[model samples]
Target: MREFVFALEYEPGCNRVADALADHPDARIRSLSLHATDDRLWRVDHATGTSAALEDIEGAFLNGDYYADCLATDDCGATQTTRVLDRTDDTLVLYSTWERTPTCASVPHIARDHLGDGVLFETRHEGRHYTWRIVHSGVGDPAAFFDALEAAVGDCARMEMLRAATTEADAPTGDGTGGASGLAPEQEAALRAAVEHGYYESPREVDVGDLADHLDVPRSTLTYRLRRAEERLAKGYVADERFADAPSTPL
Candidate 1:
């Protein structure tokens, strides 16, 4: 089994859902579902944010145009439909299905085309970056996949390869020195930047945007690193059994 992970960094306002995240900067999106297909890309997003922000996200999601960025052409005449479920004050659930087009497009369709069928997709969207972690059952050529992905991304967004196969640095433990456990150097740097920049202070010494500026990286890049770091640290505080039966859903 191989996990070919990659991320897409879109220009602000280039992606509708990403643009929506920009409007509600505090909202975070996570997907966990296996539901997808060649003609349809299914998404089940669990959104956390202020109620107003969730509402806005819901509206933006229901707007079919929110999916234009994923299609081969804005006028490809593809169709997208969404449904809202499990509404809450701080969290909202959204499900969407995007039908495919003849033109090679979308991470899901393109991945299936090159990587073979049954390639699972998972995504996290916030701000300009839409991160995808694809789970493929068989060994595949990541370079070939990325080349196809890069062409599909084209001028609309910048693409970066984050992590694919596990590496020594990705080990659950670090060198037997005073170094903290697990965190990749980049992840650690992101957390350090955030803390030093007062990102954790009340009212925040600076929001993500300003902190990102201080670090001289795009906001999407900073957020991706920070979020990955936090997830690892947070898991350290919980019991392994707590997630023994957790669902692994794909976006």
Candidate 2:
């Protein structure tokens, strides 16, 4: 079967939470997941440097016409009776039930309808754009899915294909040696976090110190881990000619 990964970008003005996050420089929704019960429910996980902004989010939910109820903060975040919300200090997790299904124009909703069974791996808000990682099995024609997605999002959004590969359904999944790099889970997480946080950016949005703080590790420890992880990834790239055409950047 064929599996495709796509990164979809959405406009901030079109989404309420996205707009609120855009207003807060240090606040962002790190991940989001939606499930359809009797009522459609969304689980939103976010991070913000400022606590006041989080309170503002809570207020937005309570006062807004969209949500039905609001609850107090727990160890995780906060929960509304109609939904679930939690915040641990700077990190926020929200579970909200929607009164109605998402419109057909929604990109994710379109993908869901077309793919039949697709996976939303991750979702994050950065600046004016919200990026989503969606993976799906190819139906009769994968191009058809893209066409539908483009039509749903219109000319305002951008969609990039990150990876497309075919694998047997019963393929072995032991140590992941058959995969790209055999780096340990911790190493993989460190490398992904580094890239996502813009550690490799020319201007460098975050430094090792900042990454260490985010990971709750000592600066020296983070340095050692990153160095080792980079080395492993580099060696993996060099050993595999399949990635020879890929970008030279470590990420």
Candidate 3:
């Protein structure tokens, strides 16, 4: 089977939810998933590092002209809505169903229409851009997929293929580095920068404010990015360890 990992950037004006989030200086969508069973059913997870009002995040969905209803909200500020998606102290799971219309132009709809069977592993609002990490399988011709995606999105500049390959090995195992390949570019960079800046030292040499300044981003943005990177790294480490402990097949 062939697997391709792509990082797609969309114009804010082209995607209502992304555009709305971009409008709020402090708001961001941490992670998002669009299930294969139904493109309408979506799972969106928010980052908790920002002090932005919950209403500010909710308003993006409510006014985006996409989601039909707000299903629920937790103490952590995570929300569940019909047309769009939230954060929690412990962790919240929110499910939403989307209705495709001529007016709706979400990235998931475009990918579903073009990439067919692709899995959206991550989505985030970074600065003014919305970056999506998607893994597409059974891709016989990646070039063809790119062509179709560009046609569907109406803007080639917003989309780009980050990595693609056909192989028997799982992603983290392929590079022999225990799944570090799964980390997004920004995430990896953030983690590396944190270590280099002594953020992980016993006596922290750099605070969030200093790191933010060094990264040339808001403190909230830096915090969210670091948190996400750390979580992914930890998960990758655990998966690698589990696989290593598994009984080996007889040669």
Candidate 4:
């Protein structure tokens, strides 16, 4: 098995992510390691027993405080947990370390494997600090792995840039002209609070059911409203003005 280790730095004054890690029933502390006076990281073990299914990790990262904690959502729901080392409140450093596990059969060479073509694979971010790696195995060429890695890295970089831009600005100034704003006046008032509540920043932490309760709307209705709001934001705000006048088409 090959191993790779890397570190992610968190901006300062954003440590409330630690609170998200509290009380997650499914949360597990795989392995913890300390590097220096201010650096500590964790290695999450994804392997699970047969009866208990593996849960998908939605988002994980160390906040500005440098400790690794992340929001996770499975097919069932979302939870956030801080997976930090004990006895240290210093800067959190999330690390990734891997080793190959024994399998019943010998691994086949990527070059020789015919199953490599026309195959699609999916990945899930495991531990905090957005530690991403292969979550599933399919027949493939090792060379193809490079393409996937590049795509993931690019996506991460883009997301980080967008997040930084949003943080610097005042809560986004929506004109409220769209009929799809879905949020009630009270909910709209609470919109800015959503980031602090871990909503806007982490979609995985959003509980549609809970949001519906707070908004006094049906869960489905809440979902439709949120979806429409997202659609408008993607099409109107995120897209360039050149595409603004284009009509929507069925995919």
Which regions of candidate 2 are displaced past 4 Å? 1-3, 36-41, 59-84, 99-104, 118-121, 166-251
Least accurate stretch of 10 residues (summed lDDT) in model 4? 159-168
Over 177-196, each residue of candidate 1 has an lDDT whose tens digit, in order, gives 23364565666888988888
Q: Sort by lDDT, best first.
A: 1, 2, 3, 4
Point out where model 1 deviates above 4 Å: 66-73, 166-185, 188-214, 234-251
lDDT tens readout by residue for model 2, 1-251? 45554444435444445456556756766666654333234555555646876766655555454442211111212223323366766866765554333231344445555666544446665433454545456565567767977765565455654445554463355333333555545556778889999999999999999999999865644654576578767886776766777688876
TM-score computed on alpha carbons, candidate 3: 0.53
Q: Evaluated with TM-score, which candidate comes out highest?
A: 1
Give the Cα-based TM-score of candidate 1 against the true structure: 0.74
Clash count list over all predictions: 4, 8, 4, 9
**TM-score for each prediction?**
0.74, 0.50, 0.53, 0.21
**True-structure RMSD for candidate 4:** 17.7
Clash pairs for candidate 2: 76-86, 76-87, 77-86, 77-87, 78-85, 78-86, 79-85, 84-95
Worst 10 residues of 1 by lDDT: 170-179
In model 3, what is the error at residue 25, expressed in angstroms? 12
Which numbered prediction scores highest in lDDT against the true structure? 1
Point out the higher-scoring one by lDDT: 2 or 3.
2
Off by over 4 Å in 4: 1-196, 238-251
Model with the higher TM-score, candidate 1 or 3: 1
Candidates 1 and 3 compared by lDDT, better number: 1
Candidate 3 has its poorest 10 consecutive residues by lDDT at 68-77
All models: lDDT?
A: 0.72, 0.55, 0.54, 0.30
